[model samples]
Target: MNIVNEIISSLKKIQESNEITVPSIKNKLTFSQIHCIAAIEYIEDANITKLSQELGMTTGAITKMCKKLLNEGYVWKYQKEGNNKEMYYNLTELGLGVCKIHKKVHEKSYNKKKAIISQYNNEEKVTILRFLNDMNSIIEDTFSEVVENYTGSDD
Candidate 1:
């Protein structure tokens, strides 16, 4: 197959693998909800501002998600001793349980893919890695140019 077709096929396989592994954990939560939870798990005691930046969401959206999580008993928010206006959030027992399940699913998917890739010979592995790296670099460069043009400045 040609390079473009090969790239498309690889991306499709990646999407399929992610779907297979993600549905179990995602069934109990919306994609955005699960992403918020996972982001919180990564940075414990994060406030709304931090969550908004990390999740690429607006503070208002994060606040709504936080409220739902709190109401569902999956997370709790508390004010710091010296900062009553700034509240921090952490996952409760239920949230941690979900995080653990998500972690397990990710690990399983990684291991399964790794096992299959390991069967490839050293030369084949090197070629695959090189192609992936080159593709990533090309994508990054193209997007950077586009963003610079849109912003009217390059940093």
Candidate 2:
């Protein structure tokens, strides 16, 4: 197959496998919501501005998601001392519970894949890893070039 076809086939396989493994996690959480949760987990404590920057979303979009999460009782909001405008958000007990569940689901999926791949001989595994690494490097370079061009950057 040609390179473009090979790339498309690889992406389709990865996406299909992800869907099969993860199932309906996306039904309970939008992509942006998951990203926001991950950012919050990373920062532990963050305000709306920080979340927007970290998630590459607008403040308005983050605010909307935060409102939904708050209304769902997955997150709690509080104002910092002497700064009502500077509100902070963190996962509530329920949110943490959901996070733990998601973590386990991810861990199980990863472990299953790892076990299967571990059955391969050492040299074969190394070859597979190297190919995957090269694919990742190519994708990253292409993405970087696209982003730079879109942003009118010179590099």
Candidate 3:
């Protein structure tokens, strides 16, 4: 139980440490912007609708975010050879640089977690995995409930 509490505190710190500064981006990238950049990098032919679906945001919301990303040189939007009406977005060189930095940070963090898990035996690892999955499910349910109940005001 004590170890579990300690782990929870440490994980909170780890989560906070995810913010990394990219010298070129100039503007501080929010969590959403980082994810949006990563998604564009991962998906070829990423259009507004596709990104909106992937990010669970409306196309209008995505368009607004992408506008900022484009103005900041983090992304580029263009149409395909025959597609004038639809536009696709991709990471620019600077965006790719930031993504690489972000990826390395994530990989290092996960690698540390994996190393810690390796200390446990197979049975313990299985138990830990199951516990994590169950906790994640509970968190998802709780988050949905919170969103549903939110009034967005103190009064």
Candidate 4:
């Protein structure tokens, strides 16, 4: 178990944990779609620009996802009074249901991780956090080019 291998293993577990199935959804949602719906619910006055920022996606990509969500009855588009140019998005009942299920899954994951981390002393926790933050910066810098050119087709 080298550090790289350990980090890769942890990422795999995180991915597996995040894979969710919503019973109420007639059409199976992709991970991106599920997160987009959740983001809509989480972000106040959700719009393509805001969603793009929140999801680390391009506005163009967010627009496409929004259209699909709208067609599937998961979300709806609207405009604030006196402002028709900047469209906003919100969850329909169906989207809300999916978001709720997504939230429960996240809560369960959070609690499990919290319990594990709680065993660590404050100094150990700080050290772990600092290490993770550094690793995040390094990974981001290393992958910046790949991420910038990504088409997001895998999602």
Candidate 5:
């Protein structure tokens, strides 16, 4: 297969791999939802805007996901004193547990990748990083254009 096809296939596999159930929650979560939960844990007093920025998602998408999360008992929303208009989120106990699980999952994945990459010398590693960075830049530019030109299409 060509390099582009290989990369696309790898991405599809990664997406499928990321669909996992948090043992504590016992419910399957989408990768994006898990990241949203992680973002909430990472950001202090997370709000819709902050989460959108952190996740590189639109506020509308974030809002919809957050509603599901709130309904699932993972997060709760609150308004700051004298700031009724703006709301913030806090991870529930369940959300914190999910965060811990997510961290462990990531640490394991990182360790596995590190083990694979450790065989590469410094120069090879630098080359790998450079290649990945270039790919990311290209993807980012393409994503920006797609978003800019996007019209309503049923997902």
Candidate 6:
């Protein structure tokens, strides 16, 4: 198989893996909501704008998601002393617990992926990263082209 095809196949396999979930969030939160919790816990004085930017999502979506999170007791909104316009959220005790579970899962995933990279020598590692970067650039260019040339499709 071509190297690019092999890499794409590997990525498809990764996406199909069943071990990509957090038990703490099982049936309680969507993966995006759980990820939002993780981002909120990481960013100091977390606000919708900051969380949305960090997670590559829209503030509108974050606002809606946060509503569920707030209602479900995962987070609570508060003001910074005198500034009510600037809303921030802090994780509730339950939110913190879930965040911890998410963190542990993230660490395990990171370590496993790191172990895979560790098998390669330094030169091979640099070449691998460069190739991936090039692939990403190509995809980005292709996406831009698709958007720029978009027209109504007929099926």
lDDT of each: 0.81, 0.77, 0.86, 0.89, 0.89, 0.84
Give each model a TM-score: 0.64, 0.65, 0.75, 0.71, 0.78, 0.70
Residues 30-89 of candidate 4 have per-residue lDDT tens digits of 889999999999899999989999999999999999999999999999999999799999
As a whole number from 0 to 100, the lDDT of residue 11 in candidate 3 is: 64
Q: Quick one: best lDDT, which candidate?
A: 5
Backbone collision count in every prediction? 0, 0, 0, 0, 0, 0
Q: Model 2 segments beyond 4 Å from truth? A: 1-8, 15-32, 38-43, 48-73, 92-94, 153-155
At residue 34, candidate 6 shows an lDDT of: 83
User: Which has the greatest TM-score?
Assistant: 5
List, residue by residue over 1-155, the lDDT tens digit for candidate 1.
99889878987676454322333333456656767777888886789999999998889999998999888877888987888799888888778877887778779989998999999999999999997898779878988899789898644
Candidate 3 whole-model C-alpha lDDT, 0 to 1: 0.86
- Superposed Cα deviation of residue 91, candidate 5 (Å): 1.3
Q: Report lDDT (Cα) of residue 81, candidate 3.
A: 88
Flag regions of model 6 displaced more than 4 Å.
Answer: 1-6, 15-20, 26-32, 142-155
For candidate 4, which ten residues in a row score worst on lDDT?
A: 12-21
Model 3 lDDT tens row, 46-122: 98888999999889989998999999999998988876899899899998998898898789989998899989999
Q: In terms of TM-score, which candidate is stronger, 2 or 5?
A: 5
| Candidate 3 residue pairs in backbone clash | none
Order of the predicted models by TM-score, top scorer first: 5, 3, 4, 6, 2, 1
Q: Which should have the higher lDDT, number 4 or number 5?
A: 5
Clashing pairs in 1: none
Q: Candidate 2 or 6, higher TM-score?
A: 6
lDDT (0-100) at residue 87 of candidate 5? 84
What are the per-residue Cα lDDT tens digits for candidate 2 across 1-155? Answer: 99989978987787455322234333367556756765666685688899998888789999999999888777888887888678889887766766676678779989999999989999999998998898889888998899889889654
State the TM-score for model 2: 0.65
Put the candidates in lDDT order, highest first. Answer: 5, 4, 3, 6, 1, 2
User: lDDT per residue, candidate 6, 23-128, as tens digits?
Assistant: 5554456678888888888899999999989988889999998989998888999999888689998999878988888888789989998999999999999998
